[model samples]
Target chain A: MEQNLQTNEEIEMQLWEYIDGSCPINDMQRISILIERNTLWKQKYDELSALHTSFSTNVELEQPSMRFTANVMDAVAATHVAPATKKYINKSIIRGIAAVFFVMLTAIFGYALFSVHPTTGTTSMLPKLDTSKFNLSHVINSETIMIIVAINIVIGLVFLDSILRRKKEQQAVKP
Target chain B: MELDDTAVIQMVLQGQQAAYATLVTRYQQYVFTLVMRYVNNREQAEELAQDVFVKAYRYLADFKGNSKFSTWLYTIVNSTCLSHLRKRKDETILLEEEKMVSISDSNQAERPSDKMEQRTQKQMLENALKHLPESEAQALTLFYQGEQSVEEIGVIMGMTTSNVKVKLFRARQKMKDILQSRFSRELNL
Candidate 1:
């Protein structure tokens, strides 16, 4: 009886593997032969087959709301968009630009410093202008200054509003 | 030919944001069903599922495409549900609610006299599924419903392939035991 129980357990394992299509061909053939010869093996196989059939047929996929995709897209739009290319700004490109800018700035500053010789104690290379020739009053009016300030304030407020709106939209989407 | 998941992913990565909608629509029902296995709340499951898609979009660049997209997506679904379950940790309430739903279903089934036997058996199987440990139930569901191979299920569930096979075997055995006991009880009734 104990040996029979062990055999039954082994048969059950093989039957499961067979159902899953994981059993080797030779072992499957052996199980098939056993099923034909043994009443117990056939009964177990039939039961398992019925359960497998029921599971495959009756189990239905649960669906979400019709707006599920739309909601996801909206959430995506509200978030920061990823760059189109995987390498949006290559590190080498940025380094090369910075190197060029550094070299140009250094050369300009070196020339400016050397053009004014400390031994001569003169700023001859620098362009000279009459102080009276340039007047802030002639170039700008109080109204123009006020308009520039107002435009800056408006731009700042617009930027701040957009940032706040994005924050609110993100909060709304969260479960 | 229609675009495959990899092609759609490429499009999304290339800044064609609308391409992501195809992915969401294709997998919404699948992700929702997988989440429902753990959450058991339709509304919460839907929310979590949407969150899954949003996370996927945010992290699309991180996907190296080593595995199938469905396998990778299911990994996200598994982790999301796990964290949610951790926070909620209200198993008793959820089980009670599920029992109520089961009772209501059986009551409705009893009314349809002609199909009573079929409906009762189906309901019994469902209830037996509920009685399973969450891991076992999930394994069984992924195996049968997702049509996932053991290795794919291992990727989703974070188990070895052999472990997944063992779990599937035990889950089936437990389900059979539950059904047999329920059948005997119904006969006595």
Candidate 2:
């Protein structure tokens, strides 16, 4: 009795696969023979066949309103559809980052120039530090320093402007 | 000649945003129907479907094209509907375990003619689907209406193909069982 019940469920499952066209050709042929000869198999096959046909062909699908495509397109446009891609790289953010890096580099270079003192008489087995060819005045002049500072400030301001604009844009998108 | 989904995607990515209308039209019925199975309301389902398309557009670049576009689309549909369902689970839909199939009879063996049987089964199947768990109902719809293969369903539902097959089998079996029980009960009444 238990085996009969299992066989019914299993037969139904195989018929489901066979009707779905998921069964291999060999299994299809085998199941076809069983349906042709066996009354139990034929009865189950008839019932499942109808259900499968109805599911695939006769089942009524829900249709959207006429404005579905238009509404979806409008929503797509209104939303910020651009993904986080390199193509949308912000120039202002790049400039800001460059300014910050330049400021750090200039500070380090200036500090190194000051740190190198004139080690004159304290010479050992190690070669004495040669400060003769160094042109400190030319490299660290007031005008050049001021120019670098000005460029840094301009880039920093542009970066700041972009960030503020982005914040406003984010706020606008929130609602 | 009509452009395929990949070509349409490339066009959209290249700044011709209007090209997305093609994909939207192609998949609107599918997306709308799948979401309707979850929300079960026309207005909310339409709204959810619209949001899904927009979300898909936003992340269109993430689609690698290695898989069928429909399979990828279903993944998005599943997530969108699941999240929305989570919010309304308490009020609207029952939990999976709570959805059960109760068969009242197993001995009635009278069968109808082929044509009439098909029609009756169609009606019975539609009614029986309402009594099933959402996963099974969806599996049936995806297999029948969406014409999705069990393998593709596995990818979408994050299950193995065998597991998906079991779900499909159980779903069909339960629907048939529900109809039989209904038939037996009506005869008794």
Candidate 3:
């Protein structure tokens, strides 16, 4: 697509995609033409091309210490290679967890169903249930749910803030 | 002859432990460099990178070679670094862009006019990458140096392919912005 980008950011974005060679063949042709014809486009493309070339040619990978491989090998020797997670992860434990969850779900359904109170008079062949006796209004009314939802929203916002903001001072403390 | 990763892995699996070192030697720089993106200190990054290799070795049996070895290795690196950062979440690394100060707020403009111009293109690009968010920097590095496709980067970084593209775009802009502002005289921009 011929992107008539307005802002510098948008223009750079298109140039980056073009330099990365990810754009379609037609878009690449159009971008090539624009780079050749348009002064602004040429400047942007040249700068971006330099950046792309530096990434490939000029940038050097950070090398580890000479003993890095040896240290890793030493650790590997100390511990078994391909340590199967199966050794530590117990299938029985997983089955136990599943069973617990199953029991909990069954209890919840049982409580929901068995909480029904039989009516004094039968409406039909089956006895009528006084469902009103089980008032969910006290348990899950709009106000309570809204409060829970608000609290959740507040928690989510706090978490997002924490992720976005990094406190530089305390970063040295190792984990 | 240098064996491919898959062949080396197969040899290692078949009781040829020495062959595993070849894989480590090949990828040590890459793993170390990527780890340094999250943890800047050489000592800490080296430790983490070493642990990543060990962990990869431990889980070597599970690497069925369905994906490229580099992709699998990078996936491990991402998880390892992320988990390490999470462990010390109370004191995790800072996002340079999210700092309280911006380039304008800082004394970048006050430096000698030739200071930025004196820097090599490599050094300028390195500084720019340092200022980018970790994931964006990683996306750029993996794309150019790691020989990873956008889809592979997405898989490694737990982002969508489009999200990887967006990150790369942002990274390019940020790099250009940084360079243009810092070394305006050197670059014709």
Q: List the lowest-lDDT window of 10 residues for candidate 1 chain A.
A: A166-175
Each model's lDDT comes to 0.78, 0.78, 0.78
Sorted on TM-score, highest at the top, how do the candidates line up?
Answer: 3, 2, 1
Q: What lDDT tens digits, residue by residue, belong to model 3 across residues B35-71?
A: 9888878999999998999888888988766578888
Worst 10 residues of 1 chain B by lDDT: B180-189
Report residue A19 deviation for candidate 1 (angstroms). Answer: 1.2
Ranking of all candidate structures by their DockQ, best first: 3, 2, 1
**Candidate 3 collision pairs:** none
lDDT at position A122, candidate 2: 41
The candidate scoring highest on TM-score is: 3
Which one wins by TM-score: 1 or 3?
3
**Where is the poorest 10-residue window by lDDT in model 2 chain B?**
B101-110
Clashes, model 1? 0
Candidate number that wins on TM-score, 1 or 2: 2
Residue A105 alpha-carbon offset, candidate 1, angstroms = 42
Identify the runs in model 2 with alpha carbons over 4 angstroms from their true place. A84-175, B101-124, B183-189
lDDT of 2 by residue, A1-175 (tens): 9999999999998998888888999999999999999999999999888666656775556799999999999888876556645557888899999999999999977766665555744423334666787869977999999999999999999999867755643343231
Q: List fnat, each candidate.
A: 0.47, 0.52, 0.61
Clashing pairs in 2: none
lDDT of 3 by residue, A35-114 (tens): 99999989888877876776788677888998998998988887666545676789999999999999999997776566
Candidate maximizing DockQ: 3
